[model samples]
Target: MEQATLQTPLGMATILGDRNGIRAIRVTDHSEGEDSIPPALAEACGQLREYFNGERTVFDLPLAPEGTDFQQTVWQALLGIPYGKTISYMDLAKQLGDPAAIRAVAAANGKNPLWIVIPCHRVIGSDGSLTGYAGGIHRKKWLLNHESANPQQSLF
Candidate 1:
């Protein structure tokens, strides 16, 4: 249940983690404290900085998002989305083997707590238009545009 807040391109982000892994990473407009940064928090911040700088993709840090089984499944499916690609909620529902569960899938996505890491931002409307994001559609648009404009360079 450790937390740290830092500024990000889209806004300030509040990162929460425990010894097990990161529980959530939320975007905010301000920081909450000035205490010394914990080691895990610093490491997470470093990884986030690398991500924003376009130097990292596929984060290796641990994560432990709190959610229902269905939500967890939806979040895992989101992880499969490639960095610069986008998918529709309907497509995601189909991938879950329940085409009619598009609304449920969208609900799960809306509840995603890890933000950019779990990449709920990559989910769009059936018309290929950006839709709901807890962090705001503007941030979602910026994230999509950022990934598109800065294609990752392979480290291998």
Candidate 2:
């Protein structure tokens, strides 16, 4: 599979995929960008950069995230969530025609392979507090704040 690790405001986002589509995009700390970027990953890499630069709000890429059918459904539903918006797990569950599936929905959300692209960070506790994220709660906060329409101004 084609691969590339690029630096971003969150961290080193390691993207893995090939001509079929993007398989995964995960963020980690203090890693170097790949010395050689694969041709297949050029567009995905470029799009991610644009997202961080606030030049792009929506992603258009051939994504091939591997997960169960239910998980796939959850991820697709996640895409419906607009940029700079938040959705409670309850709302997400209700949208899927299963209000009782909140835990199942949240579980599937946690397993989302595509990070920022999937916008799982937009899902929060029903009370509006940031909830658990595979990338850590702190990273979730940073991501939400980054995409905020009314961005919090620095006290400095």
Candidate 3:
């Protein structure tokens, strides 16, 4: 696996991947030792740059995040959420055919490793409040607002 850290409006963005596919995209406060920019991560970096620049609303990169089957299912559902749209945990669970799975779905959403690519930031609390995000709620809000300001028609 190789990695690269990029500068974004929120902070440093790190992408980890290999020939298999991208494994994760982590946001952090620093990028000291993360400057290598391996060839395998180039496509992901370019897509992310387009996303942050509001030129790309939909991502078309291969993802290989390590997680349980249930987590993978939740993450895939998250990908279905349109850019600039939000969904409650309950809604997501219901879409999964089990409204009682709200907690579980939210847990998996929190564990999403692909950051903006997986779009875990698009999930919000039932009452419309921003909730737990690995990248911080402030960053979540920023991402949501960013997508909102640049809404695109849903292809689904």
Q: Who wins the lDDT comparison?
A: 2
Alpha-carbon local distance difference test for all models: 0.88, 0.93, 0.90
Q: Pairs clashing in candidate 2?
A: none
> How good is model 1 by TM-score?
0.91
Q: Per-residue lDDT tens digits of candidate 1, residues 1-156?
A: 888877788878888997788999989766555446677778788889898998987777788999999999999999999988999999999999999999999999999999888989999999998989999987998888778956445489
Give one digit per residue, the lDDT tens place, for model 2 in 1-156. 878999998889999999999999988987775547789999999999999999989999999999999999999999999999999999999999999999999999999999999999999999998889999998998888889988887799
Total clashing pairs for each candidate:
0, 0, 0
Model 1 poorest ten-residue lDDT run: 28-37
**TM-score order of candidates, best first?**
2, 3, 1
Q: Candidate 3 — which residues are off by over 4 angstroms? A: 31-34, 150-156
Clashing pairs in 1: none
**TM-score for each of the candidates:** 0.91, 0.96, 0.92
Residue 18 of model 1 has an lDDT of: 76
RMSD of 1: 5.0
* Among all candidates shown, the one with the greatest TM-score: 2
Tell me the deviation in Å of residue 5 in model 1. 1.1
Q: How much is 10 displaced in model 3, in angstroms?
A: 1.0
Error of 3 at 62 (Å): 1.0
